[model samples]
Target chain A: MMKDEELVIEARDLTKVFLDFWGRPKVRAVNGIHLDVRRGEIFGLLGPNGSGKSTTIKMILGLLHPTSGQLSVLGQSPRAVSVKSRMGFMPEESYLYKYLTADEILNFYANLYGMTGSAKTERVNALIEQVGLSQARDRRVGEFSKGMARRIGLAQALLNDPDLILLDEPTSGLDPIACREVKDLLLALARQGKTILICSHHLADMQDICSRVAILLQGEVCATGSVQELLSTPDTLKLTLQAPSQTTLMAVLDLLERETGTRPQVDLTGRTLESVYIETVSKRKSAS
Target chain B: MSHYFGKSLTRISALAGLTVRDAARSRLLVSLGGILIIGLIGLPLLISGDNTLTRRLQVILNYTLSFAVTMLSIVTLWTACGGVSSEIQDRRLYLVLTKPVHRYELWLGKWLGIVALNALLLTLTGFIIGIMIWHTLFTSPESETGKRQACEQFLLARQSRLPESPISEKQAQASAAALVKSGRAPAGIDAAQVATELMKELKNARFVIAPTGTVHFTTLITTPLSGINDGLLNYKIESSRPERSPIPALWEIQAAGKKAIHLSVTNYPGLPNRLLIPGAVMKNAPSLTLSYHRLDSSSSATLFMAQNGQEPELLIPSGSWAMNLGRGLLMILCRLAFLSALGLTAGCLLSTPVAVFAAFFIMVLLAMSGYVESVATSGAFYIPHEGHELSKTWLDKVILSQFKGLNRLTQPLLRLDPVPLLEEGRRISWLLTTQAVAWLVGLYTAVTALIGMILFNRRELG
Candidate 1:
């Protein structure tokens, strides 16, 4: 009896301090963090590098124990293996056993979670096809490029069809196309009612699919809310109108300024590089 | 709930599966296996005492097995190191660490994996040697051939012969008991002495002991003594196998006090003076005694005499006395366990291999230091002045000082100079048992626990 919108994660004053070999303090990697995520939501933890977003995610997953404080997932301790049996993880880096074939790596992980026999085979095969890595699944993980590795990592992370999934920098090293494919995959998983916690520095990507976002800075949550809420402020409006020549835009901005009082600026007078690039690529695809 | 998890068995089995596969694929392990077979098989064929094959088997038991343990333990370092360190290096540590698994499970799994791997390799190697030995026993190689010279002539000669099965069990037991009660054993109240006295009591017994060095030359090893001449069987140089021609003794009928002792070291001789130890003298040498005065680095000696004929080296009389193989095996396993324990502990605490290796080196040094305090302790090598009786505490400290243990066959195996246990093996299995327990349950266990704790505390996923 799984509850929809039930709290899947809860952290109370979670703190993690990294220590040196001699047990001396080195860094307070994460500090006094409090967070909760409703079940079946794509929760995004956004931050720059070393911002403790990944640390927080790991704590939620029980890959790391918090130095102080407590955390639970699905009403159970993160470290409970039984709970882990219902969880999947995608680390920031695909630190997979290189010597193992992708198939072997998947099987090893499946076995770790106690998935076995036909169920394991069926799940691994489906996930491989789903992640679009069916062709390369037999290859040694060592032979994989970073992008390919990330694809396999995603596939393995989904093997258990876990109730809670944690993805750290899931699309960090993928090509744009691959990134789009992964984004679509996350959305599809979300649509299927899987809860996901993703940690990423790519704020744009986070903003796109996340049900809610937690923006972190220096081991603390700076802001947390839905993407639209965080993006909207009384002071700024991101207006997108039909593109114009610089002269026409300037005139329009002057008129708008006269009406609105505060300075209005003519921005991106013509299609920006990203827009142009996307358009060109789409046009090529259509022509093909 | 963490206790009695069925996962320990499951994890160990999975890890063992991987471990066996890995070792089987290793070229070094395979080659090492092949060489060990050749050595074990070829060695027995090369040497045969006219009277006892048991003595020949003794050589293999004492020396070859020690070497095996050393090689196996060294192999454990790489296996154990790769078990975790390589995973971390390749960034694959995250896979297991993040699996909602207990940290201790991973550590324990890895240890079990490596040990299972080592045991497989060593046990297989041991099996091959065992089979060869089994073959050697069922069919004694031309035992009816050695020229039977007159007994009195052989007895008077300066010989270095492997022991023959002349002494009976009763004689060996009597002698071993006599040796212990008389305190004639190298160290007082030593297990070896008791065993040796018992062995001496066994006047007419035939048994094969493991590898031991013997010197039956009729002469006091040191000090000016009498009537020694050439024409006698002064020296018989043999490789690990039987030889057609005897190698000449390095020392002939030499002068007195100047000291002329033939020394051919198969491995570095144990801690003591270099002397002519023949194939017989070491034959069933009473479990060797490791005598080290704590805090004292002064040299010590072990004098083993494998009598020329009818002097049963070991008291035991088995119908099919192959050799003392299982005797030191427990000790060997214990030593390996300790080495791995130390290595694993260091590996956990320090991410750096150099740091870990350094830590391992320190552990070995400490164990060896059990012999005597290092000169690094203080400038005190020789004995104190006669009238100056040192205090109990200082003496204890000095006695417990660090030392570089004797690494005869391999490096200081026990690190704690486990000679006393060997010396007392016959009468007192306790010393050896104690050392084994200390190794298995003490250093190795403690270090393994430490390793587990460190690993459990580590944060890898982040």
Candidate 2:
């Protein structure tokens, strides 16, 4: 485990209970879940629907207070204004002011961080370009397509160049190419020693970028470890090679069965569908 | 500390700017602006006044200015209510709350935004009305006297000074006691109520002058009327007999140690008349006593003066019409500021429709506060029939108490109304404007804003 100083987010028995109007507890959205997100790591929170992923993220962002437990972000209370200054959050939906242009939205958030002058402009401009929204920066967000709005949301999240970023379903409505781009961006941010916490249902994307992951079930963490430690199969072995003739493949299978006294499963390696779709689109765009 | 405050100000200003931009781009404001322009131009053309230019100008000013203020007030309340509630309903507030901005800052920013929008719209309306008044006054084919009368009576900012009451409360109370002892007072009403009613009747009786009898009135001018060329004494007389034609009267006016100036004049009942006092007679004279003597001894008709204390006013030109109009607009702005704060507080506590409804309900309640006060003061829940009485229940008492509280809370809002003053060409004084700011904006608005900020901060935005 990393030392406490290097921990960006630390939680002990963190819990949140939603209450009805009369103050009776209605739902235990997050129950006694512990988390430690260290510096310079991509941490994934994996869960099904209603598994408390969004609830946990909201608590961490100080949008909702925890019913009981202890939580600290960057060695300060989650609600500390100074701490929020160093953190960025992207909610499940875009949730942007529909009347404001993409550029105006970014500028508004930048101002909240007390940024001004050329530095703010440069940072906003760069984030717009990075999120692939430069073409639509002047258009109102209400007029944008879902994918375009998602891109602008991401740009706003990066406006202040926050040290710790929390994203809930970051690529929820993106196309395959944009999804890949987002994953690539997460990896790049992780390499730059920035801590990132992502809550998502996209397991393939999570597997591609997350160094460590915690799986939640019914507001409880059921499993947590490094990706390799949690997913590896010690007794299973497989080999990948270039395509062989039918006769050669049969001979190899017979030899392996005779030696091990067991029949082995055979499968061919293939590229993910996401990769295939992205490649096709990229090729078409370049040709055009 | 200053740096920190400066940063906070920047954040708040940015939020306010965004709010204004949002409203500017919305269809609601655009539609309202179009409607306002149409009303300003069309309402005057639709309502043709009497052929006199002064009456025409008065009609235009009264209707157009009132329409503008009413429309703007409604818009202000609607926009402020929706600005916060809809953002929360749509989850757009999530993005803002998660930032470094405090919730109070957000609330204040929205309020300031609404107030600024109202200011802009009100300025536009005032400018258009001003142009119309100027054009009508300067270019119309009306006679010079007609135009001059319009300027003096309906355009200049004049302060009114009323005559002191001739009867005193002590004397009225003593007379009421004597009447009660003699069994001449009404039996059902309380003694205090009887004394109050008797005071009003006795004061009215003091204004009646019998045949050949003289009545005197003293007026004290607090401010020195050095530069003013003339002042006007406006009076309206009522008679016991409505059919009586022109009654001759003599007026004697005397100043401290100066020769009495006497004039013979004819008075018509139920008609308003003004006598101009020359600057020379008013120069350096702080006090004047006027004696009215009835010259018609053959007729038994008695002249009656109104007891409302509005008549027999001495009008002194205080300031220009433009300045008065500006002050009137400022008063309206103060009212809008209070409404903005009220709507914001409601929005913080309730949903959009509920907030809007609650705000409007409060406004309606304020409009009917006079009635509420009367009912509360009456101390009865239901009106009793003739010769019937109903005892009070606990619920009735509770409701009456609530109404009393509401009256007390809303009294400040209804204290200074600018529309009537502006229509009548009376001065909306700087002192009155300051009091409005104190009560409407300073006290009422600040209280609502504090409540809103507290609720908003405690609320969970997720």
Candidates' DockQ values?
A: 0.38, 0.76
Task: Score every model by TM-score.
Answer: 0.64, 0.89
Off by over 4 Å in 1: A19-25, A238-255, A262-288, B1-8, B18-64, B85-91, B127-338, B352-355, B362-382, B385-462
When summed lDDT is taken over every stretch of 10 residues in candidate 2 chain A, the lowest stretch is A1-10
Please provide, for model 2 over A1-288, each residue's C-alpha lDDT reduced to its tens digit, 9 standing for 90 to 100.
445349999989999999998999999999999999999899999989899888888888988898999999988988888888888888878799888899988999999988889999999999999998888889999999888888888788878777899998888999888988998998998887889999988888888899999999899999998898888889768788998999998998899899989888888899978778888889999999
What i-RMS does each candidate reach, in Å?
Answer: 2.8, 0.9
Instruction: Write model 1 residue lDDT over A1-288, tens digit each, in one string.
Output: 777868889888889998887999899988888888888799998888889887787777676789998888889988776787778888878777666778877877776666657998998888888777888888988899998899889888888788888998898888776787799889988888889999887877888889998888889888888888877898777788778787998788888889899777545556556556767887998999
Per-residue lDDT, model 1, residue A259, is 85
- RMSD versus native structure for model 2: 4.1
Highest-TM-score candidate: 2
How well does candidate 2 reproduce the true complex, by DockQ? 0.76
Which has the greatest DockQ? Answer: 2
Report how far residue B109 has shifted in candidate 1, in Å. Answer: 1.8
